[model samples]
Target: MNKWRNLAILTAGVTMLAACTNNPYTGESEAGKSGIYGGIGAVTGAVIGAATSSKKDRGKGALIGAAVGGAAGGGYGYYVDKQEAQLRQRLVGTGVQVQRNGDQLTLIMPGNITFATNSSDISSSFYPTLNSLVTVFKEFDKSGINIVGHTDSTGSLALNQNLSNARAQSVASYLSSNGVAGNRISAYGAGPNQPIASNATEQGRAQNRRVEITLQQMQ
Candidate 1:
């Protein structure tokens, strides 16, 4: 959708929201504020997500993509647009899931591809993927990275916690060694405390054991 059209929709939503500040149902101030903001947010989000989406799917993904990109109402939208495109192109077939939220980008690397079973040492096979990522980071130096590691609930919490931290550091170290700036990256380990999926099944457990490289646009 054109920016002008999007702006028109946003303006209408905000105006309507402002005009109905009092909730009719509960007689409370700012009635249905959440729904109003959600509507406007969805409009603005299209600006970021629509570009990367396929022409046919643009309409469906724009609201989500823009919301995820946290699009500011300016040229920063374009900045995120370019970065998302570059990531999609560079990380193709790498078994990494790239997700965008507003101005943030996250690269989800599953344990099966990122590390050996219960090990934090850098896997030699993963080097090329990291290299590809480093290349992009160099090209897009205005982004700060966060490497977060997570583990399934198979081992003791203490051990899993340590392993998670080790995995994060290991990835960060590898990226640093390959020319990505240390100052641009922060590392954290969540261990089993932050599971994206249930640990009751192997599939869920596998999904939980992962590393996430998140990028935030620098100010």
Candidate 2:
């Protein structure tokens, strides 16, 4: 009877938490997403707590787990949210696109703005933009940075792959030099294999030739 009552209470708590998906006052979707993490954590923690605790203390343990897990999950969401806001503010008019998908943030740097034609060297004009990124990255030091390079399908596979790798390395080196932790960064080259746009037209090819930097929670 006690076990059943505890389960019922947990279920009702999770349901109420899920109902907060949309913030009534701010109307921000992010609040709702954070709530979802809290809900999931609460459920998992409750299960573990009930399983581990003595039968007599099962209810208390479940409740404690639910509170701790919910706070941890929701705290992660809030951390990412604050970082995204700072990124958007810092990257304004910088030709870099700040994108958010859940707790991850990606910055798409176009080839024309980031590098020279068919060259691995970064364009001089893009330095200021990178400096701004350095500031934000240092502030949000808990995230891992992934730098990926891409190219159009106009070149031989080997050449494109090599060039992409070189570009990624250059970006990684720059970030490392600017005080972002080296261990937290990884660079990869997708070359023409991961073309985001078609290679059939000049515009498409141009779009495909770019670098993407993705930041994700370290843990």
Candidate 3:
């Protein structure tokens, strides 16, 4: 399955490159459609250029970078899966739902689990879950993780966005203090922009308030 996904991504990259004729802004036309893996010439050019940092070898860097980036992305995905499996048990009682899709892991935390009305602080009851999550972060390899805070449409858009952002930052800070690298994590507050359910009802409002943790590629 992993192999197939990689192949599919590669094919898409190729097709995308092929369809591009020129960069409108730069007025530069790429020499090859499949910029990274189409041939040995492209590879050689990319490598030499990247290694030497010279115009003659620009192609080499491009080729090497592409190959490295793709492999790294795939390898990181595999690693995330392994880590998620190990952390799944620890996360079970956190009032948070975990969803895994291929190389991605999403941790959905209900508002009641983490904060008070229109606030960003992680509630006392949330300590166990937050602490457990931090422990998991400490054990896992460092990677780019996004902490996204969301809210139901209960207030002004500006207020919601700020609160959401603050919540995400709080979560990020907790993890960072617990051993996760600060630089590897990003906080985002998308107040009411993305809700799992409508805010028309109490249940839906509860559903809309959440924190989303997205594990990105490792450095």
Candidate 4:
């Protein structure tokens, strides 16, 4: 909820290019280049998420926020290439949804896999995706990973907020556990306030309940 407008504006139209290597957070490999959008997005999202989250949740929030921000920034100028196409095929087979806006690569997850109604336990099924992400990160030369958590707008505002935070933390924990470093990853929860679909309907609610993973260059 913090500086979304300003961050989005500053990230618009920015482009970046870099090499891929092992992420400090995950120790897994990554691909794709880094960019201005990714760097700024990471910074803005981390700062804002840290400021708004409870003290207990701030570390996870910063990790997720930075990743998503970096993804958004790197994504703005990304282009699909042979490697990305191959990555897409691999992700699709593993139940990891992939979306592309230009050069940016967005990975979408069903809430069921990333969280359990206010709980932050990472599903076993999610590990393959995480491993794949690490591979992608190592393959590319980017320095950011965007991890964003979302929820359906059904519960009280406070409950949803905590749920979102927990979800983000869960994903961050998984990445860190596997090999990701705290410096390269950022996490955050949008609660129910940043719904991408209508929460009034089950289909829309499902759409709204998700976590987005973006891989791009850091600005």
Among these predictions, the greatest lDDT belongs to 2
Put down candidate 3 lDDT per residue, 33-79, tens digits, no spaces.
22323333333333443555555544445556545544443344446
Error of 3 at 157 (Å): 0.9
- lDDT (CA) for every model shown? 0.77, 0.85, 0.70, 0.68
Candidate 3: regions farther than 4 A off: 1-74
Using all chains and alpha carbons, the TM-scores for the candidates as numbered come to 0.67, 0.76, 0.64, 0.60
Error of 3 at 201 (Å): 1.1
Report the CA-based lDDT of candidate 2 relative to the real structure: 0.85
lDDT of 2 by residue, 1-219 (tens): 878676768856874674365533357643445677777777777777777899888888788777777766676666877788788888989889988787788999999999999899989999999999999999999999999999999979999999999999999999999999999999989989998878999999999989999999886
lDDT of 1 at 55: 72
Q: Report the number of the highest-TM-score candidate.
A: 2
Q: Over 4 Å off in model 2, which ranges?
A: 1-33, 40-69
TM-score of candidate 4 on Cα atoms, chains taken together: 0.60
lDDT accuracy of residue 1 in candidate 4: 43
- Cα RMSD of all models vs. native, in order, equals 13.2, 4.2, 12.1, 17.5
- Candidate 1: worst-modelled 10 consecutive residues by lDDT: 68-77
lDDT minimum window of 10 residues, candidate 3: 32-41
What digit string (tens of lDDT, one per residue) describes model 4 on residues 94-148?
Answer: 6568776546678888886655655778777677777887666656645477788
